[model samples]
Target chain A: MADKVLVFSRFAKSMLARFAEKFELLETGGKPANEVFSAAELADVRALLTMGAQPLGRETLDALPSLGAIVCYGTGYDGVDLDAAAERKIAIGNSPAANASAVADLAMTLLLGLMRRLLPADAYLRGGGWSGARPSPLLRPPRGLTNARVGVYGMGEIGRKIAARVAAFETDVAYHSRSRHDVPYRYVGSLGELVEWCDVLLIAVRAGPDTERIIDAAMLKRLGADGVLVNISRGSVIDQPALIAALADKTIAGAGLDVFEREPYAPDALSEFPNVVLTPHIGGHTLEAHVAMQDCVIANLAAFFAGKPLPYLVKR
Target chain B: MADKVLVFSRFAKSMLARFAEKFELLETGGKPANEVFSAAELADVRALLTMGAQPLGRETLDALPSLGAIVCYGTGYDGVDLDAAAERKIAIGNSPAANASAVADLAMTLLLGLMRRLLPADAYLRGGGWSGARPSPLLRPPRGLTNARVGVYGMGEIGRKIAARVAAFETDVAYHSRSRHDVPYRYVGSLGELVEWCDVLLIAVRAGPDTERIIDAAMLKRLGADGVLVNISRGSVIDQPALIAALADKTIAGAGLDVFEREPYAPDALSEFPNVVLTPHIGGHTLEAHVAMQDCVIANLAAFFAGKPLPYLVKR
Candidate 1:
């Protein structure tokens, strides 16, 4: 009999099909695992698959007496209580850097979309504003990408990728991170300095306690009226109300956001602004990224089942 | 005394303010020269300024007897009758490469926006589809830029710039042009071969007699169901009706079009497709590009007025 893997998060059936082929899956449909499965059924579950952002605490870990591995489906493993898991001798694994390129691609997409005023331009063309030759303030010439200052907040895989992509457009790239890495772009000592120095600030920092609400109103105001903000990082990196106020008062020129303060939920106040480009949290949602992540997930699960260390075991 | 310069196109007052300061302006507001100014008023119009896409044929040339120079405000000079001007010993000038970077930037913007399904993604977020956990087929994983085959249909400044931009995304870049240049990208023999070979075909070929309607139904069909087409070049290069049919039948996955068959007007049939991203001809409409082109225009006009060769004269 195959070792059963409990599904701790809601996932599309297609996404979960691969895991089903390799292991017996206990589908909880994002409900309490203990409620869905009897103690007898749960006692044999040795591994669990989850979305990295979904909460996996000590309480949930204790429920699965036999659970020895916690496999995060994406690069982020923020919600997993690492201390709790480690105390129980449960190994943690995550698909790191699998979605970096896709997320970086999205960061570029949103950045370009916002900077070029794509939404207004498309609407002007579609709404007969172009044909009627009506005055469109939004269609006016924008600050082109050539030689523009693009500062990246974070020097991680996604940030490095974003810097590389922007550099190709003839923009000068710089970054601010917790620590300096070997990269071509110039590094700024502080986030505030990076925001003040560049015309566009792209946030690709890892989400954690140190980064939560780091980009507050003061930082946004430092970004100035001509500056634009783009966030592919977690929404907690920015203060939602501060960003809204910044947009309202033109403290910053525009914003391109893939992640929001809340997943799948952005207020009308933010979306109502013509200068803001809003997207559902889909920074890592690409066919290539998904396949790459699944490969990591499969590899870790396979190794764990064979009485070996998880190939992609997370190091604290 | 300032030399009389006829403005043969409709332009914003702000755009023409600098020109007005240097010349005695004869604003025709894109009206016929004969209608706007009497022959006496037109006689001393030694130089003319025009939008590159507006037609300035033999009839218009004959009306301005002393029109020694025709300075185009942008890169293209297709609208001017070059042969007619040559026959009359009139010099032609254009701001060559002034808008190349801007146009290239917009091309990337459109391509990224289309392939990433930005419109549908934005709509899904705003329409509460995301919060509702509604199945968003449009938001499904897309084939990202990484390692994707990208074929450039032109090898001009704009095309070369585009190739450089996409290459940074880790895509395999190739090109098909009239003659192979010393570009870093691999060269393909023909447009058809390029279409069949690459996942995305970007049209950047210049508009001329031999190149008109080159990308027809057959070419689009060769691009295949998964292929995407992005045209930043003139609309005459693609058969608009054929493109419509191809889209209707799903011959191509999607398209990002900046120029169209008609100026300031697109057919409802073309605009109705969700897969297509349309922008009014604003590829070269950036402030930086405009300023650069204006500088070229000023230089050409100043040279002509001083009885010297146009500094930025057209070679042919």
Candidate 2:
């Protein structure tokens, strides 16, 4: 008999197959939290495997009386209330570095795509219009990363990886965090200052309540016209109305948004600008990343049953 | 006492303004062939400014008795037969290396835009749809330059610059050229084999009767599945009808096209594909590039007029 697991995750079927051999997997294919509650009416599950799509809240903990631990899929455990988990003395594990490369890749994708007006050219061609031949004269060589100031907010796994990629382009990489550390790049004391300094400001911080709407109109105005705003974090980090206004007024050169506030409901104003490059929120949904995350869930469960240290436990 | 310039060309006000301060400018925006034929009707004129857009054929050339040298603004001087100029010892010069970087940058823009599916996401968002939160699964990262086998068909200056850029991405760059000299990249013997070996085949060769339709139905098929095509050169280099069929049948992953056989007259089939990233013939239109080309023309003419060696001359 293997360790019984509760997998409350939503991913491609290909990712689910990674864990089939290891444990007695009880899975939900991206079902809502309420459905998971109904299904786990009384199942004595050893652990729960959860990711971004499913948040393991206090209610979820209350429902799962026999839950040994909650294995967080990606680096972000924003959905899981750590204080609540500490109160219960339940173990919480997460995979942080597993998807760092994937997220960094996505962030770069957004930065380049938005800055270069990638989508507008496509629209011009597909709409049977020959207008793309005559682009605005303002366009220059896709802004060589060399000698440009690039600011990264949040010096965590994704941010560090992004910094590494930025360095490859010969960019002057800088960051802003709680305290300044001795990194190769400049460590700004304040987020607002970093915004003012960087030609391109990339937000890779967490998307929790504390970080919600952190990049509002004031912060955006600080960036002004010379800046390009790229948001690869959660939608809540930016104020949508402010962003729309900034982009429309050319307060900033352009914006590349992969996530938005009230997702699946984009702002009407953003649609009008050709300068913005928008993508569905898929920062860590690459094939390699999804499989790695799923595999992480399986590894955590195996370690828990073996009475060993969890691979990546979130100690609140 | 002022320098007299014989303007036998159609000129934009922008170009005229650039040279107006220093030279005694003559503005013949569009004088006909027959009018230019009667050069005896004109007064003192020293320089002839010619463009392909207007007729400066044998009769017009012969009639311009007072013209000492012709300064053409474009890179291609197919209109004025150099033999006629050489016989009379009339110096001729055109802009060179003016737009290489700009064109190269545009090529990369198209390449990134097409491979990343930028337009589809934009279309969805602009059509009152939300795509950023729940992204369509990403295709490969344009087969990252790090490990890609890139084939360059024309190893000229633009091609060499492209090769250097691809090399920066850490790709194994190869090329097919006529009687290749020593270069850093591996030179493949044949275009057919180069297409087969490359994950992406780039065309940077010239477009003339000699190289017309070099990439036809059979050549595209050789690229096979998962391969891509990018044409920054003339559209006459590729068979449009064959390319349409290849793309329709998914013979290759996609293509990024900048030039066409006919300007502003791209086939509907090529532009319609979601996989294709199409741009009008504005590859070499960057401000920096245009100024550089103008400078190059000035330098070339300055050398010829000063009885010094010309920096770059077309070997005809």
Candidate 3:
């Protein structure tokens, strides 16, 4: 089989450079995304790779009769219709730790940036916004990471990695998980108690059926007004409305979020707050993650052809 | 005989909160920062506690006819005329390691941010930009802290502490100092050679009259384009024009600098690039540093009254 592959996500030219050497890769040409996914085009493809936060509907899955496997370009395979694929025995694969360090690096960056007001302050200086560039009293008085009580909710691969990085700052770390992890840090057995103890709370747990609305108003209240909250996991993992209200009322010091409740959409209330640092979910988007993910995709393809176990079989 | 004291820079309100428990402290809070003479203000005040980049000039020195001691609220005493105070047999004290971990914390944050372009991507996303939010092949992949070559420029308290932290990241650490530090890491004999070997270079050396413009354009290029340059030391330590030209021409890959050549001032050329991450000089501004600095100030004051040796003394 000459192995035809369809790519739906944006990636470095480097990935295509690799694909060109082997597979008959169906590249998403410079055509805008809305023009993609014509039914006639999907009929012959043997494999599909996609990303983002929505499910590729059943109709699209039905259209590709030759599709033998689907590779999620990055972590968070929430968009892939796993049930239909499972029924068809079409394999599904996701690159997990491939983007782990990248996302972990970004989470810490956002935490430091918000606490220090890095972007606004840097922009102020670069734009000549400062006559004297009088340092803000708020910026100067904020505390560093030493001995900070950092709470990690959802102790998974990314959370564990982030904990290791946070520990390097000499921060006291703890986590709330389905059960206690084998790690050495203090593990808080209860969710509310964990929120109360942490100076900074990061949401890295999976955002799904079990995790929806996990950090609601009551949890936000437990986090206290002096605390900072960082969410890079899933948009629904945080209750956006309550978070906005808390930030507006000074019930929380600040927030740094990568995922939003809605894509291409943000509450004006969240955007208006100077203390809240928001990103459009680019945490796992580093070049290092891209190439590693490419390797995993190749591994998955190689296994399917050999009739061996899939390297990263999606649980869902 | 009452003990007389002097203060250099203005102290934060938190200092009063923490230190007013003991000692009669005086601040230089008048107009004409130079005119806010620490020595003159503390003509009779028992202890002088000052902070930040303010100067302890001759007017203040001569005015304090009864002055017996001086205490700095921060790690640096460059602004203080230490020689003149020493000539008068004034006991000079400072807070060192108390503020070190905080600055080291920021250094790592900057290291991760600049190497990863955290702020620019966050800003782009929060501004309603979504195309770049997902991980794509176009993105550079993430690199782990495992086994990377990291260089430390200074061997002072902050540098030493940073070395300990860097080791936790599994980075092979090397350092360049005026003398070979006995720390566990490899000590490079020359600054030029250290730059050549390090994939990531951290500038943590103390700033004073003798150390200005040590890293000129030639040094930046030797690190090569793939190397990351981090400056947590004074802005003047690195030549501004040379760095700006080098960054603009792409001689180096990226830089993360907290202290700028002319702080409240950044290179106009740097603003155009997304790779560089800049912050207002905040290495020592964490809350932990603040409280610890206050403690150091208080300790120095206690030592002055008790006639004990001050922990940190400037070399004349």
Candidate 4:
């Protein structure tokens, strides 16, 4: 008999087939973890495969008495109860750096979009504003990205990729991280200094207790009236209320946001702001990123089942 | 007394002030050229400064008997009758490559926006599509720009800048030009071959009698269903009707367009297409580009008055 594995979230069809080859795959289809499987179904489950910010806590882990491992499909594993899993000796593995390129691409997309006033410009042209009797300055003239100073927060894989791409545009690249790495980009020791130095500040930090609301009122003020903010990391990194206030008051020039503090619910105030560009949390939603993440998850699961070290093991 | 120069187009205030230092500046304010000045005004006009696709034929040249030179503000001068100017011994100068960076930036913005499905994605989230009971795949997943082959239709200054930028993303860049220039990018001799070789085709050629409607039905077919087309050059280079049909039928995956055949009029057919990203003719409309172009115009005019070799002379 195959070792029973509970799929707690949706996986691509190809990934599902691969999972089935190694285990008796039981799918939750995004059902609550405890509700999806009865006591009898949970009794033999050896592992759980999940995606996104699904809450996996002590209660769900207690239900699966035989559960030896939990594998997350994407880089972020903030929702998982790491301490509980650590105490239970149930190893947690996440697909690390799987969608770095996709996220970095999005950072550039949002930056360029905001710089070009893409949303308003497209709307103006489509609404026949361009054919008016007089030329309307409906679309404000854009500032060029070339030779502008770009400061990246959290100099991780995604941030580095963004820096690399912007350098080709002749833009000066800088970064601020917990610790400086060996990369050639100028390293500012603090986020405040980075904000003051850059015309555009791109956020790419990982979300956690330490990082929550790190970009608060003070940081926005430092960014000043001409600075633009682009966030591809978790929305929790920014104080949404502070950001909204700053945008409204023109304390900062504009923003391009992909993630929100409340998922699927961007505030009406943010949507109403003409200078801000908003997209649903899709920074890493490319076909390439999806496939790579799925493959990463499979590799982790295969390694764990074979009693080999997990390739992307999450340490508590 | 200052030498009298006819300002046939509206110029930036800075440029106008500079022109005033050397000449008695006569402003047209975008009026019909014939109506803007009487026979008295035309007789003493020693030079003319104009912009855009303004028609300058034998009639205008004949009227301005004292017109020693004509300086165009931007690169495209197809509307100016070179033969008429040559016959009259009139020197023609243009601001060659003044706005190349701005145009290249917009080309990338459009390409990135289209590939990432930025338009529909922004709409979906703003319309609260993400709050639905199940995720709607309203926006198609994008293919990665990294490692993709990008074929530039013209290897001019703007095209080369785009290639340089994309190279940092790990994208392979190639081009099709009338003659192969000394560049690192592979040059394909024919447009058909370039279309076949690339996943993304960028149109950046100059529009002329020889190049009008260069991209037609057959070229679109050769681009195939998976390809994307980006045009930042002149709209006259594309057969608009053919492009519309191909976009509607998915003959090409999608397009990112900044120019159209008709000046300020984009068809309702294009505005209604979900896959295409349309912007008005603002490819080089950045503040930096505007300032640089104004300076270029001033330099050309100054060079002519000083009797130096024309800085950016256009030969017939």
Candidate 5:
């Protein structure tokens, strides 16, 4: 019999087809594991597949006595409780950097869309505002990408890609991260300094205790009236309430967001802002990205089942 | 006395303030010059400022007996009758390449917006479709930029910039232009070949007799069903009806258009397609681009008024 892999998160059925072909899947359909399966069935589960943004705490880990590995489906592994997993001696693996280019592409998409007033421009044209020769403040010329200062909030794979993409647009790029890497762009020591110095701040940092709610009201203020913010990272990295207040008072010019504090549930207040561009969290939701990520997942799972270390294991 | 400059196109008063400070302005507000000013007044005009897309024919040139210069406000001079200007000994001038970077940026914006399905994603989130778990084929995975083949249809400043921007995304860049240039990208011998080989086609060729309606139905068909098209060049380059048919029949995946054959008037047929991202001709409407073009216009007009050759003269 194939080794059983328990599905611990809500994923499209098609996304798990390959996994099912290779393993016996005890799919919970994003329900509580205890509610979906008996303790006897859970006792046989040796591995779990999960979305990296969903919380996988000690309680859930305790329920699966035979669980030896937890594999995250995407780049992030933040939702897994590292301390709990370490105590249980469970190996963790994630598809790091597999979706970096796709996420970076979306960052540029959001930044350009916000700065260019794309949503309003589309609305204006579709509503006959352009043909009627109606004066619209929304369609007024915005600052172009040339010579704009761009501050990247992380230096990971996604951040590096974002820097490279924006740099080609003739913008000055700088980044603030846990440690400076040997990237071509300049490195800034602090997030506050980076925010103050740049016209746009792009959040690509990993979410954890250190990064959660770091971009608070004070940070938003320093971004200034002409500044724009774009977040493709976890929404917890920014204080959504603070961001909403800053936009309300025009403290910042605009924002482009793919993630929210709550998934698939951005506050209604965000829709009211004319200066913002919001999308459902889909920074890495590309066909190419999915294939790359799936490849990593398969490799990790295959290694674990063969009694070898995961080739894409997440470091402690 | 200051030189008299007749305005042949509609312009915001603020855009003309600098010119007003240096010249005596006769603003026609985009009206017929004959109706806006008497023959005597027109005869006294030594220079005229116009949008490059508006037609400037022999009749208008003959009306201005002492017209020494025709200064186009933007990079394009396609609308100006170069033969008529030469016959009348009028120095034709334009802001060549002043808005190339801005236009190139928009080309990328439209390309990303369309391929990423930005509009449908935005609407899905804003309309609560995401929260409702409604299935949207529009939000399905798109072809990512990494390793994708990108074919540029022109080799001008804008096309080169587009190639550079897409290259940074790790795409395979190639181009087909009137003549081969010393660019780093691979040169395809024909437009049909470029279309066939690439996943995306970016149109950046100039608008003129030689290039009008070049992207007809057959070329689009060669682009294949998964291919995307982004046009930042003149709308006359693509057959609108053919594009509509191609889009309706799924000959192409999607399109992002910034220009149309008619000013400020996109067809109602275009509004029905969810796959396409449409914007008014605001490709070069950034503040920085406008300032650069204005500076060029001032330099060209100043040189003409000083009885010297126009600094930014359009070649005969």
Candidate 6:
């Protein structure tokens, strides 16, 4: 019999068909394992394929007696219980760097959109405000990206890509990571310092317990009246309430957000502000990134089934 | 007496006040010369400082008998009658390269915005589409800019700036200019060849008698269904009806337009298409560009009065 594998989330049907050739795929159809699969159905499962934010905890691991590996479809694996899998000697592999360019592109999109006030400007034009009196002053003139200081909060793959792209705009690029890398950009020690130094602060840090609410009211306050905040990382990295308050009080000039603390539920207050540009969490939702991520996931699963070392194993 | 100068258009009050120190300015308030000023008021006008597209013809030149110089506030001077100015030996100066960076920045904004489907995505998220059943696929997955071929229609200052910026995104850049420059990108002689070679065709050529309606139906059809078109140059550079038909028929994938043949009025047909991103002609509407343009205008006017060569004189 083929090695039984459980799919915890929906994937491309074509990709699943390819996987089916080598494995007896047991799909949960985006339902909970307990709700969709009985103990008997999960008992023979040798490996599990899941998405970045799919809940895979100790209880689910304990139920899957024969499961040896867990492969996540995207870079982020925050929802997976790393310690639980580690204790069981189960391999944890995630698709990393696959979505870097797409996320970086989104970061730039948000930054440029906010800086140019694209939303309000488009609205004004579409609403016939341009043909009316005082057309020149219909929208506030944008601040030029040329020579503007841009600070990347975390100099990871995505952040570095953003810095590289911003450099082409003739902007001054600086970054703040945990430690310094060999990159040419100026290194700031802390987030507060980065905030103070930059006209725009781009958040690209990894999310975890340590980074939860790292960018709070204090940092937002330091960002000042002319500063713009752009968050393409996990929403948990920022205190949403603090950001809302800051935007409400005009503490910062504006923001461009792709993530929210509550997924699919952007705050009504945020929508009310003309200075803010908001999008659903879609930083890495490009066709290229999706294909790359799926390929990475397949590679990791294949490697594990062949008793080879996982390609992108998460260190416990 | 201070040199009497007829202001053809309304300028910033601060700029007008600065000009007031040197010239006895007669303001027209953006009205017709005959309606705003008598022929007597224009008789002593020593120099004319106007915007690029202001209607200045042989008739207007005939009325301003003392007009020795014409200073355009922006780079484009298509509306000015150069032959008439040449016949009368009137010097013409324009603020060239003042808004290059700003225009290039907007071009990138439009390109990225269209590729990412930012407008509809934002609307979807704001309109509670995210809260619906399928949130992830709310917008069509965008193609990555990395390694994508970008063909620039013109290799001028703004176009070159755009190419430089696109390079940072890891895109392959090429150009189609009347004459090839010593730039790093490959040069395609014809617009058809350039369209076929690129995934995105960016139009940045100057609008003139020679270049009018350059991007017509056939050129767009050559761009193919997967190709995107971005226009940050003059609207007259494109045949609007052809573009609208191409968009309606899905001959091209999408478009990001900042200019239209008709000023301040986008066609009703364009608003119906979700694939296109539209903005009023605001590519150079930045605080930095505005200040630079005004300063350039001032410098040109100052040089003409000082009887030195105009800083940015256009060859008649």
Question: TM-score of every model?
Answer: 0.98, 0.81, 0.89, 0.95, 0.99, 0.95
TM-score-best of 5 and 6: 5
- Give lDDT tens digits, candidate 2, residues B1-316: 4455666676556656656665666666667634653455443455666653233566656766655567776565555766777776677776765566556556666655655566775666667655443444343323433357889888876777667655554367899987595789998999999999998888888666677899988899999877888888888889988888999999988999987776557888887787888776656654555576667656755665566655656666
Better of 3 and 5 by TM-score: 5
lDDT of each: 0.90, 0.71, 0.75, 0.84, 0.91, 0.85
TM-score result, candidate 2: 0.81
DockQ of each: 0.79, 0.28, 0.51, 0.66, 0.79, 0.67
- List, residue by residue over B1-316, the lDDT tens digit for candidate 1: 9988999998878789889889888999989988988999998788999987788899999888888899899988888998999998889899989999999999999999998888888888778888888879554589998889999999999999999999999899999998999999999998889999999999889888888899999998999999999999898899999999999999999999999887877778888899889898889988899899989999999999888998899898
Q: In model 3, where do residues sit more than 4 Å from their true spots? A: A10-15, A27-41, A127-140, B1-4, B12-26, B30-47, B52-60, B131-147, B167-170, B179-184, B261-275, B311-316
- Cα error of candidate 2 at position B63, Å: 6.5
Q: What is the C-alpha lDDT profile of model 6 across A62-168, one tens digit per residue? A: 88998899988778898799889888889989888889998999999998888886776677766667656345433456787988999998888888888898889
Query: Which residue pairs come into collision in candidate 5?
Result: none
- For residues A1-316, write the lDDT of model 4, one tens digit per residue: 8767789875556557766887788888878766877888888787889865777899888999988889998888887888899888988888787888888888889998888877877888777787663455544567888678999998888888888888877789999999999898999998899998899999999888999999999999999998999999888999999999999999999999999998878988898888888888888888788778878878888887888878889876
Question: How many clashes in candidate 5?
Answer: 0
- Chain A TM-score (model 4): 0.93
Clash list (residue pairs), candidate 6: none
Model 5 residue B18 lDDT score: 88
The digit string of per-residue lDDT tens for model 6 on B79-158 reads: 79999999988998888889889899989998888888778778877777876745544445678787789999999888
Superposition error at B304 for model 4 (Å): 1.8
> Worst 10-residue stretch by lDDT in candidate 5 chain A?
A131-140
Residue pairs with colliding backbones in model 1 are none
Considering lDDT, which of the candidate structures 1 and 6 is the better prediction for this target?
Answer: 1
lDDT accuracy of residue B126 in candidate 3 = 57
Per-residue C-alpha lDDT of model 5 across residues A1-316, encoded as one tens digit per residue: 9989999998887788888899899999999999999999999798899999999999999999989999999999988999999999999999999999999999999999988878888878887888888987654589989999999999999999999999999899999998989999999999999999999999999999999999999999999999999999999999999999999999999999999998878888998898888889889999889998999988998899999999999997
**How far does residue B160 in candidate 2 sit from its true spot (Å)?**
4.7
Q: After superposition, how far is residue A132 of candidate 4 from its true place, in Å?
A: 3.5
